[model samples]
Target chain A: MIRRGGRRGGVVAAGLLTGALLGLGFPAPARADPEADRIGFRSYFQQRFPDVPAEAWIDGMYAIDEGARQQWQEIEDFPPYEFTVEEGQALFQDPFGDGRSYGDCFPDAGRGIRQRYPRFDSETGEVETLEVAINGCRARHGEPALSYDSKEMLALTAWIAYASRGRPMAVEVPDDARALAAYEEGKRFYYTKRGRLDMACVDCHGRYAGAFIRGDHLSASLGHPTHFPVYRLKLGGMVSLHKRFHGCIRDVGAEPFDEQSREFRRLEYFLTYMSNGLEANGPAVRK
Target chain B: MRDVVTSALVLAACLALPVARAADDSRTPAVEGVLAAVESLRAQAVTAGHEWLGTRSLLDEARAAAASGDAARALELAEQARRDCELALEQARREEEAWQGRVLR
Candidate 1:
């Protein structure tokens, strides 16, 4: 009887082991450390392109495109995004309906804070992007929030990015489980293949970085977040990062979620956090 | 003898023509069924917020082949579209449960 009871216990233990193995193959990862992920992410890019200077990554596609580099240099002489920056400066200082300005809502009067954006907001238990934070500030002042991809918001972020230029990105992923979960979701979104093309974000920016495809060089993902609200000569206008996300997913023939959705917000949080040390070099011109 | 041969030859040609045409026309209902399945699968994918990828383009090509009277080609394209939509639906369902395994930790 003791032997039979022992045999039954062994079977139960074996069943539990099998279930644990199956769980590892499916749901939430057991190990989730932001610092480890960041280190691994940077190391992967550095190992792939050992010759490219770390700082040069800020130039994005131009880090590999010589011709574009020259054109980008020329464009910088009189940057096309200059006018939008000026417009944003005006908007930043202008008061809302209650005569309270955007400066009143942020640390240091919203002077130089672009690099710390797409933060994991513990209070909300979600990732909050710069756009959302900006809108939140307006909402607190009894003003209607601007559109996620609006011209005004683009200009506003451009102004903020310009103000924060040269400051290193310092996004933080807290010790909280929700913050780690948000980052993990973004990482999954980055690597997961979707659409008929069966492509992930890593397929281009991670795997094919510096390779030219159809008259364009694939930029490394390492410093992709550094330059947003970029003036694209191809589009003849400034394009926001969330807009770029939508365009890329569509390029693979996938249906994209709306900009500022939870998926995208978490994606932004992960990417911005990954670019922790890169300088904020936005309102820049791009091909 | 010459008249008999010519008349027999003409009779043979008439009988063969309908048989070949019937063979082609026989594929029409099967193609139509697959096309309907593509739409139904696409609806499922959309409800799940999954992208149907090139399914729509494949469906369009299938209709174009049908319009051009190529029953075999139409059937082939429609079947491909149906398969792609089904795959998309499967991918959507699997990702909901499996995306975590691929996460960088």
Candidate 2:
């Protein structure tokens, strides 16, 4: 089940698909429009939940909960947490009607399958996350496409997410013609000012990263996405990569993104490219 | 004499528990101030050896409830969120330091 899939063969499929999409679609849209300046950071903290526990706010009785630092450390098992790896491993082995398993689709060569994701696939000129690739795997095997947010995918993705853990994110906006094009689009998005503050992401995370806003200090976006499926304290639950992007855009005073919007995926690609070389901190603990 | 000691202990606990007085006095200003301060620290994203973001954020919400005149909520949230934030902050700080060290290298 844990078999081989080469890298060279997918280029043909990608090229054909990219060409077809561009053939009929409208031209690329304008960059993000500016939003008004609203000065409040509560959405990051407020709307996520209500009513905290008693130990969280007692006067001078903080030792009641804040005392143990090691108590909450997540234990990393060899296989990682979640249940879908078993299914994915199974699918990897089962052969399709053409006697082609998912592994057979790839050219016979090599792959750093888990380490490279949110990758810049030059053949199609598209930025692909692991979730996209998994569906690609499904389509290659002639299986029905899985939803991007499905639990099966989330679990399999989580395992793959686990696979990428220690690897430095190698994604790059190539200096060559194709990569340069995508990079330009992304750069325009990053610096071109958007939403309420008329503030671009560069303004705060870039210029004012360490500055204090109200009470909490702002973190620099550098090395930000080292973890995935991070345990968010705000929602009292776990949140995924794009969800964070959605929150950040909303916080900027623009309308939140539809979770699966191409705009978001492009933004995610650009952002991920920006933080390249940083290891994934997915399945992390965020305040 | 026994009655006097019991009364003294009860008085100390009363001062300690806002809800002990009115069962609704959960917004301890002192605690809220620190919680807010911790949140500020979290945004700095230089979490120390602790993981307190959740605790701090949760505490703020609870404090709001208490301040809105719900002593019961204030007391409950104060205790729980405080514990979570404190520990979380410490963990975050430690990890942040380690992460920065790696980055700086």
The model with the greatest lDDT is: 1
User: How much of the real interface does each model capture, measured as fnat?
Assistant: 0.41, 0.00
Per-residue lDDT tens digits of candidate 2, residues A1-287? Answer: 22223343466668777887788575655332111100112122122223422112111111123332233343333223334444544555667676876566432211234445566777777776666776787787678887765656655555555545566666655545655555445444455444334455656654564456665445544445455655455565456677777787667644455554555556566655545545554544555
Q: What are the runs in model 1 whose C-alpha is more than 4 Å off? A: A1-29, B1-49, B53-82, B93-105
lDDT of 1 by residue, A24-143 (tens): 575654766778888887888888888887778988988878888998898899999999999998999999999989998777756679999888899999998889999998999998
> In model 2, where do residues sit more than 4 Å from their true spots?
A1-114, A212-215, B1-105
lDDT of 1 by residue, B18-51 (tens): 7667456745677677777777888888777576
TM-score of each model, paired residue for residue: 0.76, 0.47
lDDT of each: 0.83, 0.51
What DockQ class does candidate 2 belong to? incorrect
Interface RMSD of each: 2.8, 16.6
Query: Considering every candidate listed, which one attains the maximal TM-score?
Result: 1
